[model samples]
Target: MECAGYIDGAFVKGEGARFDVLDPSDESVVAQVTGVSAAQADAAIGAARRAFDSGAWSGLTMKARAAAMTRFGEAMRKRADWLSACAVKEAGCPVSSTVMGAQVHAPLRMTDEIVDLFLRLPEQEANPLPMHERVNPHFAVQSLKRWSPLGVVSAISAYNVPFYTAFWKVVPALMAGDTVILRPNPLTPLSSMIFAEAAVEAGLPPGVMNVIVEPGLAGGLAMTTDPRVDMVSFTGSCAVGASVAAQAAPTLKRLVLELGGKSAQIYLPDAVGRAASAALSVCTSHAGQGCVLGTRVFVPQERKAEVLEGMAALLATVRIGPAGDPATQLGPVISAAQRDRCAHFTRAAVEAGGRVVCGGKRPEGLDQGFYWEPTVLDLPDNSNPAAQEEIFGPVVGVIGYRDLDHAVEMANDSRFGLSGWVHGADRVKALEVGLKIRSGAVNVNGAVMSSYASGGGIKMSGLGRERGIDGLREFQMVTTLTIGG
Candidate 1:
């Protein structure tokens, strides 16, 4: 299937530039997409600017906007199969994961809930003063104004989970009454453009939501630094996020970054079995391409052997194969380059005196795809580069800690603090440990993942949160007003 960019509510071809979208599973050209030029990116930004200024979207009642977004969500759900198939081909995700995307069940439900929250939010209310304690008759009551949209938002998402990440930025920006220009990752652009098509069909105004596919850094920079863009939301590596921050500095544009992570999982002796299962679930999910995976496992020194044994057993059960196979629990890395990178890291870990307890090489018999077996390493210490750096692949570093205090210290040693997990028999102890970990989100005893939880990292991980009420606030600006009797 051929896929094109969506701009100004219409499907359009690029300006004399294009790139092939390869199916990562087999490295075959699945679709051709236009690599939008700077001119096209400027045009997209212009379209979003005009849409925001025209007030066609911003002026609509909250209920009206909510209804429109709901319809768009439904339309996306209707075309879930096409979107999922494209995602599988481009992202090299397991078939089950692709099926989940195609259903649009999670995205739709989350977006719908966000819209409902927006509609139900209370309007700016006036703060009353004490009548008897008024110092002067001129004293007036002040109204606490809620946040309003920041106008046009430039959303640049990564390739790992295209649709989900795009929505993480786009939905919140829209809920805050902003129009958007989305520049999807070059590796996977079709799913985002498909989303734009659904928005147009669902009565989204022209220029309110535009998508452009650009193959390299040029397009991303153009969108981020565009004068017409009011805010920039980016999800990528720390290196790119730093560049984006520097570029947006001169313009002083609002920026939201969800960057890389070297998140850790702490397994107490009492919770070894459960923690081992959770670690496997995270390390194998999306082939460990997620920024929030528990890539670092910190266990007490006394239980190191037991933890490694449990983790190895779990890793052995992982099935790596083509994305569409029902039996496959894991799929190929996003590309050959990613596969090579993972291999390089594994080799480096071995040279650094780390032992590969479970997987250390590519799976057998499936040579066409960019596949790598899930890997777990027992590193000599927490200071090893493999344990500290963000590997962005299916590899986990296991480091033994002397005690609870040492485990917490080890987990907090990384510059990246995106997310962490704690396992303990006592809920209070788990929560206490979670509080000590410096991360955006902490999971205790394999609790449920909440979409409403505020998510983002500290230190080098990134800036700003993407979920919860705080996420909604990030896209908005506040105003205050006072009135006298």
Candidate 2:
């Protein structure tokens, strides 16, 4: 596939600069995408700004915006297969995983759901308390009000699940009556470009949505710090998130950051076997690239032995191979650099006295590609770097806890509070632990993750929320109107 940047409702060849998209399965160049110049970035942002100022989108009635978004959702569903294929090749994600991530099932559902939510916004309601009632009672009850859009949004998404993350930002922003400047991760830009094409085909205004493919901090900074951008929504590492925050502070641009995670999966003694098996499945899924993968597993000390055995056994069964393989459960890490990073984290864990129960080395026979076998480590304590840091590959750390209180303590020890999982035979006991755990969202007994409820994090996990009504509110500001009787 040949790919380029999308701007002003069209795909155009970028400046002479170009980069190769490597197939992580074979370490071969899968595609080449032209690097967008600063001028191109400026043009895209300017177009988005113009689109916002002209009110082609913002001027539309709420119903009209919802209708356009619904059409965009349908177009996405029509091209889901091509988008999934692009995601698989560009990001080295398993075809099965890519189908779930980029195949528009969730995106389409989310778009429709959000449109419904948008149409039901509180703005349309009449003031709840009548002026005559207020005058007679001599008491005033505040009326509920809704938020309005913050204008053009600059959405910077990561490479892990390019289209999924991009849609999380773009759908909500556009639905809220804002234009967008989208910058997808250079490693997986094609899927996002295809999404942009679908949006334009669905009748999005010419400059309302634009995409630029440039691989570096410069492009991101230009988008984030641009004065024309009314808001900046980003998903990536905490380090970069901090940088973006600092740059946006001066302008006070509304910012939403969905950053890193060191999520915990706690297993009670009763469910140790089941929890360990589930953790193994999640960690190996998508080569453990998901931000919410329960990389940190906390188990009762008494059951640690049995849990480790089950985890290792489960890890051994994961089928790692090329992304295109139908039977593959795990694929190579996104790139050579990512593979080495996972390796470094593994070696560091071993050096820190952690025990490697399974997969401490690269898989045999797969000499090429950025493949690393799914790894499970028994860490000495929660302080180990491998346990505290966000290793964006297939590495899981098992930490033994003395009891329920200790388990809760261990889970809340991290700076990150993204997501957590609790497993036990007693659902009530698990709920108690779940409430104590300081994370944005908690799963009890492998409950499904919802885009509306599953959000960003607290503390170092970055600010604001994504998904659901809360996610949509991040792109808006409140207004108040007081009338004289």
Q: Which candidate is the best by TM-score?
A: 1
Give the number of the best model, judged by lDDT. Answer: 2
Residue 203 error, candidate 2, Å: 1.9
Tens-digit lDDT string for candidate 1 (1-485): 24345778777777737788888788888787667777777788888899999999988877888888888778877877876786678887777763354224567568787887676666565456566533467664545565566789989998888888898888878877899888888888878876687777788988998888877777678777878888899999998899999999888989889999998899876776675675577665788888988889888777777878888888888878888777888888888888898888888888889998888788898889888888888888888878878888888888988887888999999999899989889888888888999998788876444457678888888899987778888887777765555
Q: Clash pairs of candidate 2?
A: none
**In candidate 1, what residue range of length 10 has the lowest lDDT sum?**
97-106
Question: How many residue pairs clash in all the candidates, one count each?
Answer: 0, 0
Mind giving the per-residue lDDT tens digits that candidate 2 earns over 357-420? Answer: 8897899999999999888888989989899999998898989999989989989999998888
Candidate 1 TM-score to native: 0.95
Please, what is the whole-model Cα lDDT of each candidate in the order they appear? 0.80, 0.82
**Clashes (candidate 2):** 0
Off by over 4 Å in 2: 1-3, 97-104, 124-146
TM-score against truth, every candidate:
0.95, 0.94
Q: Model 2 — TM-score against the truth? A: 0.94
